[model samples]
Target: MLIPGTHYRLAFTQSVLALLQVINAPTHYRLDYPDLSLILALVRGGSLARASALLKVDVSTVFRAVRRLEAALGQQLFEKSGAGYLPTTLAQTLAEQAERAEQALEAARIGAEQGGEVISGTVRLTCTDSVLQSLLLPALARFMPSYPALTIELCTSNDFANLSRRDADIALRLTRTPPEHLVGRRLADISYRVCASAAYVQSVDSHDLAALTWIAPDDFLPDHPTVAWRRQQLPGVTPSYRCNSMLSVTELVRAGLGVAALPDFLIGDGLQPLTEPLHGYDTALWLLTRPDCRALRSVVTLFDELGLALKLP
Candidate 1:
């Protein structure tokens, strides 16, 4: 026969034992374990089917992962409606924490790998195709030997590269004024000048500028600075061809198609430069970076090298 006080104590001890059992659950019972990486991948992918496609996993696998997560937390983390599942408050909190952890892990990896004094990491440089063909490639050939540690990623697109989003670290541009947020060097006062092949000159009678057909690029519209200048300077000049690429235009002119505007550098490679001016046209070429980013060791070194090598006073 136990006393009433002893019986109370025994009951209390059992209650505490039950609470401890719940608190110290096995690793398999914890939802916030290593499998949360999959949960985060789903959060980014937005839809189950999309997440499955992105992860290259079956839809059922993703469903099971989420189900296991919900069970571990003992909560309904998503509300499935006619329009697909929406995350509950608990899921949102988990997603935020997961994102932070993912970013931290990435930063840790970068820091670990690049712990030395060497300046390294990938740097993307954007420029026009023509510029790349004429200038960047040769420059890079020379540039590579010195800084073997640094890698150059050359991306050529006619459309502007957004420096704010890190689309490119440095850009070679033909704009007179760079965007307000960007710092740039005036690489050169790039001017477009009209020229024709020696054969075209012989056939068309180079003296008659208005009579000869003008060769132009498709995107160089009449309203463009170059076209506008030509129209104002050489009125009633009809174009013989409008090709998309500068290389194409060069080829057409090479075959005596008609007179075309050639960049100075492109003319250096045996195409022949025209001494006479056809139309008054001029524009500046720029190399720019986000002002905040110029301090980066890689950006600064590239900027200085390109400006000094290319931009002639």
Candidate 2:
């Protein structure tokens, strides 16, 4: 039976791999040029519009190019999601090798321009700092224990990591959709819940919404769209304090600053989930990488670990 969302080349690869097994070739099958680049682009941009925009081509031109590529190879690269496209499983497998191949191609380009060459070397990776304390650090602890020979240069911050320019091997963020060129995953649907410490709840006696104190994220001001949205849902509520770090927000909430919208993963042990809504808000967490950097054994290992670490019970 044919699966609806599978990449088109998988059939060919399966046959090729089976044949290769009989002949016992010590290698893997890989895609050729432009098709590789095209697939990478679509995956990274997350939408046809973004891909076309970034490439400085008309959307129609990109559509035609993709059709041509698909015809030549007889592969359907992407499957439609509500308004975007996700790579098929075969696309994912191809992505693993394509990412490395793209890197080698980049090296060739570098060598051509500089009239020089260099050996392959390891790269550093950076991502959200909270993931370090909540998800990443623990995942690494488990991952590192097994891959003892692997050396990782890790940095964690909320800011973007530029993989195209090789700033990091991978990154994670709470965004709806990532750019097309990166081969990545939407690891989880991160949800936010307003929470407070037992001591703080005891202090607030007001049953009325108007009198309740609140804790807000630094970016959430009275006029901000997100804050405004929350306010519509939480009428008469106002923040008592604002903090940037999730850790700091948790600390303030514990110190009786007020109720804050915090991820379940970010809150401390034994805190009660606030039944009241925090101006109703939610955001997704994304795992990102340059398309050319997907599925390096190191990346695969780490990605899987991080996914497991971030999964909600």
Winning model by lDDT:
1
Q: What TM-score does prediction 2 earn?
A: 0.53
* lDDT, model 1: 0.66
Candidates in order: C-alpha RMSD to true structure: 13.0, 16.3
lDDT of 2 by residue, 4-115 (tens): 5233344234433432332222343334454556666777787889878766778888788877755655567678889697887766655555555555544544555667
lDDT measured at residue 272 in model 2 versus the true structure, 0 to 100: 71
Candidate 1 lDDT over 32-111, as tens digits, reads 33345565666666678877886789999988988876677566767777666677765665665555544444444455
Clashing pairs in 1: none
* Per-candidate local distance difference test: 0.66, 0.63
Model 2 whole-model lDDT (C-alpha atoms): 0.63
